[model samples]
Target chain A: MIEILDTAPLSSVQDLGRAPYLRYGVSYSGVMDRLALRAGNAMLGNAEGLACIEIQAFPCRIRFRAARDFALTGADCAATLDGVPLPPWWAKPAREGAELTIGAPRRGSRAYLAVAGGIDVPSVLGSRSTQFRGSFGGHEGRWLKAGDVLPVGAAADAAVQAPGFGAEPPQTAFPADWAPPDLQPSTTAVRVLPAGEYGLFMEESQQRFWDTAWKITGQSNRAGFRLAGQPLEFAQRIEMRSHGIVPGVVQVPPSGEPIIQLSDAHTAGGYPKIGTVIEADLWRLAQAPLGSRLRFIPVTYRDALDALRQGDAWVAALRRLAEQYRSLCNSGRTP
Target chain B: MTAEEIAQIATWLRAAGLDTLELTSPQTRLRLKLGAVAPVKELAVQPAAAVPSSLDARATGLFLPIHPWCETPLVQPGQRMEAGEVAAFLRIGPLLQPVTAPSDGIVGRCLATPGKLVGFGTKLFEFSPEGKAP
Candidate 1:
């Protein structure tokens, strides 16, 4: 078991998501950065969908009740294990009562902590993800608070064999040219495919949507990110019924500012969608700090699918590498 | 200067992808680079027989002084290291192998270039016994 010593609001348990329940008005409430969680799990030889602590706030502290192996990924938060500094994207064994402190991140916003085995929370509706609106999944389906003791699943025998190891971060492994170029310092460019309602937008609005860099407003969370940019106007107003929406839908309400639905966004909405950020690029957007500017670069469906494959390949490679390293450490020791 | 320190400087220079390094001070002028056959003043090359104890790479792979996501080097000069502790990593394609310390000692100098491919048994670091000067 691991106990939360200190944590911020919105930090909670998340998996790949409660993906199957979207039809029942349930948001796909899960980690904002899927790659970070997957990378951390891979380091510990855990399953891809195992629950991990998604730390959205800074200066969080966790104490292990027993000896355990854990991996810290995603943000470069200057994490220290029992007063000894640990490298980012690193996994190591911790003795019982060891405290892991995570400071404010210098790069991304959210960090993921994955332990050997995984965070053992009772799965609700086929997933351990926290659905805050329904408040049914995860640890009582609410944000993780101080003094909460979280159970850990049994670790696989191969886990932690090569503890002091790390994998390359995706951004570094993939390189800048692998994704759309950032137009300015601290401004990210994400790939977007025009949505069904793209034609309804005025020609000038469409141009502005592609050209202008939108700043993420403070009113952002797991639900969605409200952006500040040139108002995008529709060619004509038409009444329409609420339709099902998924994460990454860039919806434009009457106010004209685009809002990208995210991990915990409502499953259905009536706002006109100008475009959808590709599934593979959502993690990058999720990691974008508040007030950072974002630009949309249009891509084709084929390109979007390719990017998804690239991400999956990266995770698979890390898992395979970890397993191989464990074998080397076990057999290659020279007395 | 110690032979290990000179070797370490060579590794650092090569790791930075440079071909030459020259240092100038009031007391001495030193120039070191790949394929240099001459010894310089104040930086005499020690006899090969006087080489210090070292950590050698167990597997042939690309050497990494620091993990890709980390800001600090895995092992720094003068840091105390325990036997079997990971001092660096060797990456072979997607696989990574830990390069561990052979004995409890003070880290002396890095003998391998970071990001460069190294062969098995290549000297990776200079490690001096606890009571001895590195």
Candidate 2:
């Protein structure tokens, strides 16, 4: 069990998401940064989609009620275990009563804390993710509070190995030498694919959309990112009925500003969508700090598929390396 | 042993990825310590007041203090740190690789100049064990 000492308003439990429920008007409200959550889970030997704490607010404090190992990934929040600094994107064993404190993010946003076993929350609608709007899933379907005690799933025997046993002495908290090259966020651009409404926009608007750098506004959240840039004008005012939509759809409302739908966005919308960010690059936008500049580079459908394959390859390689390290430890050989 | 023999042993230590090497013979005993990139090898015949142990660069990058904004060095002479503590950092592109202490020790000397590029196996700091040598 782990107890929350202090936290911000949006901190909650999240897994991959509650999938295939959009037809029922339910949003797939899961982690904003899927890569970070998956990386943290992988470090602890948990399933990729296992539940973990999605910390959006900073200076959050958590206490371990039992001795267990945990991994911190995603944001570099200057985390400390009992006043000692912890390396980012690394897993360390914690003793009972150890208090972990996370400060403001140094880079990126949304840090993930995954324990050896996942966060033990009753799955709702096929997911352990908390959907704040409906208030029906994860820890009574709400954001985590200061006094809430969260149960941790039972850890596998192999997952509880001592530090410096299975893995070499980490040069940093992050697996700098082992992590895939593309896993790191690209500082400048995110790839996109044109949607149905791309041709409806004026030629200048289309050119600006591809050329202008958009600044993420403070209004952005798990719902969507409101980008600040040159307002895009349509070729002509046209009315359209509400249509089905998914996360990553870049919708432009009457104000001309583009809003990129995210994990918690509504299943349907009536606004014109100029383009949709590729699924592979959504994780990058999810971690983009507020007020950061971002550019959208158009890509072909084939390129988008190739990008996803690369991501899968990175994860597979990491798993193989981790398995080899564990085997060496079990065989009484130093890695 | 002569000073020339001691310098040769220091070069061998750098190649072997070792911090300190000690040798004993019936006639004489010698201990060689590597410090920084300079040829400042310390040859000790017996345990002295300062038993310096060298710390090597774990990765190739520009060496920086723990805090990039801070001007003061992360670890200084006479300061004590626990094993596994991050003593300094190596900045490779945007990533900062932490240089951790191998064992609990008191800082004796900082050899690598801050903000300078250092390759792997470059000597960075020298420290003496805090309690007994592990």
Candidate 3:
């Protein structure tokens, strides 16, 4: 068990996300950066889709009720356990009564904290992901707050008796050498595919959209990212009935400002979609810090598929390495 | 015992992957411990007093006194630190791993050159117990 001493707003439990409910008007609310969630769980030898705490704002503090192993991934939040500093994207064992504090991130926006057995929240609608809009999933259907206690699931036998017991040293670090090249934060160019209404925009507007760097406005949230740039004008003013939509659809409203749908976006919309961000590049946008500039790069359908394949290959390699390391740790032979 | 005997024992302890070793005889008793990787040839006969110990690098990375941008080092030569207190940091890219003191002691010397890449098991600092030599 873990007790939340303090937390930022919107911090909640999330897994891979709920699916097959878009027809029922429910958005797939999971982690903002799915790769981070998977990486954290992989470090702990937990299932890739296991639920973990998604922390957004910083200075979040939690106290362990029992000895457990945990891993922090995604953003560098300057995490410290019982006053001892921890490296980002690393996993370590925490002793009972140890206080872990996460400070403001140095890079990226959100971080995921994954325990050995995952957070024990009752699954709702096929996922433990929190749908903040509907308030129906995750811990009490809301964000974690002070005094909230989260139960941990049963850990693997090897995880319970690993070497170092509950001790954490800086040497016991996992190298993320297998992360995909595209997953690195050095690039801000996101790949997009032309949607049905791509040709409806004026020639100048289309040119500006490709050439200009768009800044993510402060009004963005889990629902969608509101981009700040030149208002895009349409070649013709056209109206259409409400239609089904999914995350990654770049919808241009009457204000001419484009809004890219995200994990918790509405299931249906009526605005014109100029383009759709490729599924493989959504994680990049998810990790993009607030106010960061982003450029849209058009890619062919085959290119998007190739990017996804690369991501899967990286995850597979990571899984193999993590399993090998876990077994070595269990046998007291980890270097 | 001679310095050659002590050096041989230190080499043996390191080769065996053991941290400490102690042997007692009717005439003289000896204890040998391994710390940082320095010139073992220097481990010669000396006055029987508290010897300086060192904390070695746990991982290979760029050594930082505190953080990459922080001007202040985490510990000074004469500064005293409790067991488990962070004495330095090893930065690998953006990640910073804490280098902790092995025991309660007063820092004697910093062997590691700051802002340089250090290898695993490289001695970073030397310290003596509080009651020992400063």
Candidate 4:
């Protein structure tokens, strides 16, 4: 078992996220950087979709209630185990009464820490994610603070066997192959699909859509990204009704800032959507921070769906690889 | 739409091949008797009610303040206009005048504000019809 000892900005349990709940006004409350989530989970041979600890920003601190194996990846936050350096990726053993400390990011923006059995938390709406807005999942739908102890789903010793490794420490979290994506990637020229109110803009207005650079403002979060840049224009004044919003939906507010909704964004919106970021690049949106420049590149609908299909195949394959690794280690007999 | 039904609309729309739909406050019930048969085109309810006031600048220019500092804007939604009602001072040029709204309405809800540096044909402002002031 494990729990929070000290925390920084935010840390919560997340998985692939609660999808297909948008129409009900439910946002997808999942990990911010899923690739990192999968990588860390894979490292520990855990089941797919198990809740992992998502550390956003830093100074995250935690302690174990029992001994277990876990993997950490994503943001470049420096981590230490009781004043000694620890790795951010490989599976490491944690004993009862151990304190794991994480510091501010040096490169990446978000990070994931996966344990073998994953975090033990009540599942809400088919997920263990902590949707703060709804107060549904996670250690009570809130950020962890100092002195918080999280319960872990420690596997029974009979059912668990740690993978054997040579008695040697790894090079470090700075391995070129395992580094997290850019800590704060620029958003210059974001690609988008014309959406609601897309035609409302005059031809030139549409042209201006991609002509200028927009800076991501501080008013950004998992729900959506707010941008500050050249005010976008339309042809005439007409107010249509509010409509549904999806991941990648870019809503232009009265402030002229274009807000691109993310995986955790609300299902519906009143703002006009000038464009949408294609699904393929939606993951990249999670890595950007304030002041990132952005522009939109358009693509055909067929291409968009095809891209989604491709991403689905890739994630599905990744899931198989994880299970296969677990089977290999657990079963003495192999095909 | 009960909070539960508001959740299923996405699947219903995708299965039906429609891209847009709007609903009013009462629709929150999503009673099949009143919802399924409701006109698909009538989905738009109080779209602007959700947004706040904003200024979608269409062009870029310098903003020169004419009047002295007055805390809040004086113009009301239905208030009559006299071609620049609150005149203080003025200037427009090489400056990137963040085109602000002349009248109050949903902020940033507009795709474009009246005059910034919009190309030949860009949307300018989207506002509610001017009604008689109370």
Pick by lDDT: which candidate is best?
Answer: 1
lDDT of 1 at A68: 93
Error of 2 at A206 (Å): 0.5
lDDT by residue (A1-335, candidate 1, tens digit) is: 99999998768999989778899888999888999999888878898899999999989999999999999998888899989877677888899999999999988888999999899999988889998989878898899999999999998765465337777777677654744544788887889999989999999999999988999999999999999988899999955789999999999999999999999999999998899999988888878999999989899999999999998988887887676555445454431
C-alpha-based local distance difference test score of model 4 = 0.57
- Best-performing candidate as measured by TM-score: 1
* Tens-place lDDT digits, model 3, residues B15-113: 336676555433445565678453333234445543337777755567877543235677888888987677777654333456777668887688988
Q: For residues B1-134, could you state the per-residue lDDT of candidate 4 as single tens digits?
A: 23333334443344334544553342231322223565334344433343212222221121222111223333333334332122111112111112233443332223433222332113333333233222
**Which lDDT values do the candidates have, in the order given?**
0.82, 0.74, 0.74, 0.57
Judged by lDDT against the true structure, how good is candidate 2? Answer: 0.74
User: A64-162 in candidate 4: lDDT tens per residue?
Assistant: 778877767665557776675543343456777777887876555666778778887888888888888888888778766766666767452222223
TM-score of model number 4: 0.60
Query: Which residue ranges in model 3 land beyond 4 Å of their true spot?
Result: A160-187, B1-134
Instruction: Summarize candidate 3's per-residue lDDT along A107-138 as a digit string, tens digits.
Output: 66887888889998999998998888888788
TM-score of 1: 0.84
Give me the displacement of residue A247 in model 3, in angstroms: 2.2
The whole-model C-alpha lDDT of candidate 3 against the native structure comes to 0.74
- Runs in model 1 with CA error above 4 Å? A161-163, A178-182, A332-335, B1-52, B70-72, B82-86, B92-98
Docking class of 3: incorrect
